[model samples]
Target: MGHGTRDKILIAAATMLGEDPTAKLSVRAVAARAGVSTGSLRHFFPTQRELIDTVVAGMYTVDLPDDPMQDTASPPAERLVACLQLLLAQVGTGESARGYWRALHAAYVASPPSDDAVHAFLAHERLAVHYVERWLVRLRDEGALAPGEPGHHARFLLTVVNGLLTERALPGDLTRLEFEARTLMTAASAVLRPASSDRP
Candidate 1:
């Protein structure tokens, strides 16, 4: 089928899956939702696995900043904070995005060991790490950070962020953004602090 038709089918499938994680995704259901014919859906995704795979892949695809740490005009710390905020914004509690995330997590947990899940998890983790690395690199280049391994600091930051994401996913009183922001600031300070009081 044409690109438009295929895209429509994917959208329909994603919407349905978001609504009900346990919903059986079939060609007929997706086609009906998309207002397209079964033949068209088949032309795009010949099998259920293919369609599901595509949706899974799309979930991790995010719009990353071209230069997440550099705005040249802004302070490096400000730029870094903005970049981090952008990442956090993706974890929406809204119905559509939240439902999609919930469904994705359920599928990941239920599926058997597979390369697809492994690859997706690695890719997302790398992206988070790379974002942190960029911020560290920029800060170091600008002489804002103390001497250290930027990559190591980046990995550490990513670990912290991942933990925060996990905590946010669970049912509880959501941590206020102000608290999160302050916590991040404190962590960043600790990561960049100078070694000794006597050091000039």
Candidate 2:
């Protein structure tokens, strides 16, 4: 296949993944979606494993804005609430969020991911942590953080979010999920001292 054909396949695969993170990116499926032949898809990706690994690596690049804290005039609590929303938004939203987590849980139950999958998963996680740390660093720079390492505090808040996602992945219960998410975010914000309380 030509490079143009290969680009079509990759674009189609990325679109499918963005819509559904656990999309089965089989060559045949992606080829059909891309309106290309399986042979053409294989010409570019070479193998299903290669295709998946490449897609995961591409998807793992989640970056934060240089200035994630958009409103310097807002109260520290309000700024933190915005940060928490940004962090949770990374998990995704609506049916996409539910489907993403559901697929991940199913994969865990059916079979473990391969070594490449493990590496890609770790890369995704590290990127997420870095994104969160950026927000925490912003808060610290604004003198809105409690006296402690931003990395440590960011990890603690992320741990709480993960715990909520794990313990409360109730099927067809988006309302409860939203409530619990807000409650957890509130708890996360509570860890931060008021702006006035920052160390001189």
Candidate 3:
């Protein structure tokens, strides 16, 4: 089978899992979704376990930010908030976020995808924390952050972000969501900033 054929199956499976943690991704279902034969899918992924594992690994693969990661020369607070917003953006928000949700719902309601009942959705949380940690490294390099564990700072930032995403899962005023997000980012920056103005 063509390598592209194999990749298509994996991509189809991964997209299904991201949209619905409970998605049914049988070999036949995935093959149909990928526009390939069951034989082809089996050729790439010998068993359901292999297929599900590949999809779980891909659960965190997404375009988290439109902007380049290296562009962190802006003010520490601004950069910090931007990083958080990137994560929230992935979680969805307001009108733009709704489009993604609608599509995900539509995909779930109409699909050719599931395997094991296991959902590796938490990989998204881990990915978000890593993204935040990268921002912290940028700050530390610029002498803007106080010495401490980057993971600690990352967890704190992700906590607020995860809460924001959780709240967003339900119906709410967009303005309220934006306000709460801002408040969280501000508090996170304050806690992470150095006490003195001196660089080092």
Candidate 4:
């Protein structure tokens, strides 16, 4: 029963995260979602940070439905661009993208965040980095990518996506899509230098 209750709490937290990436997993919100008392939720996860860390950490193991990394037949750049698109898809565009950035600013930039808030933000950031690193690692192992730190390459790619995500929230014309596609392609190709070659 103890384990079951813990699982319920975790499932509820994860569900809330899935529903809204910005969902503040307050003890009351999570407990109510899980159909458990606040005390029960606290017994399983003593703090909001712990609950968030556990949920986001689990995301590292969850495979995306159509992971581009699995398409070995595709060129490295194509696979990587597809992967970045997956990230973009999650954030969406226009109002949806605005909401994501809004939540981020409200939580981290509007005022000083508590330690727990900072931890939650970092947890989600790490999960994004982890997914990108996995793809880079696979390309490296297959000799498709130049010898370099996968984490560095992952951050580089994520930096590109991050900029694009922010741009999506701002007003732009139809050509924005064209520019975005070109930018993603360039970023992907830039990082996918062949193993046999040296980057200038």
For each candidate in the order shown, give its overall lDDT on alpha carbons.
Answer: 0.66, 0.68, 0.68, 0.88
Name every residue pair that clashes in candidate 2: none
lDDT of candidate 3 at residue 105, scale 0 to 100: 60
- Runs in model 2 lying further than 4 Å from the true structure: 1-7, 36-68, 86-100, 147-151, 171-182, 185-187, 190-193
TM-score for each predicted model, relative to the true structure: 0.56, 0.64, 0.68, 0.93
Judged by TM-score relative to the true structure, which candidate is superior, 1 or 3?
Answer: 3
How high is the lDDT of residue 99 in model 1? 61
Model 3, 1-200: lDDT tens per residue?
49799889988987776565445578888899899999988888898777876765664454454544456556677667776776676656666555555554654445532323323233434655666777788778877776688888888777777567656766787587668767875756664665366756
Worst 10 residues of 4 by lDDT: 191-200
Tens-digit lDDT string for candidate 1 (1-200): 48889889888987875566445567788889999999988888887767777875675453465655657787555666666666666665435445656766675666663554455445445556766776787778767765678888887766666555555565555465566677666667656644353367
Clashing pairs in 4: none
Worst 10-residue lDDT window for candidate 1 reads 189-198
After superposition, candidate 1 runs with Cα above 4 Å error? 1-68, 72-75, 94-101, 172-175, 193-200
Q: Write the per-residue lDDT of candidate 4 for residues 1-200, one digit (tens) a residue.
A: 99999989889999998877768899999999999999999888898888998888778899999899899888888898889999999989999999989988988899998888878878888898999999988888877775578888889999999999999999997799789989999887777875346455
Superposed by TM-score, candidate 3 places the C-alpha of residue 155 at a distance from the truth, in angstroms, of 2.6
Of 1 and 2, the candidate ahead on lDDT is 2
Model 1 residue 78 CA deviation in Å: 3.4
**Candidate closest to the true structure, highest lDDT:** 4
| Per-candidate RMSD, Å | 6.1, 4.5, 5.3, 2.4
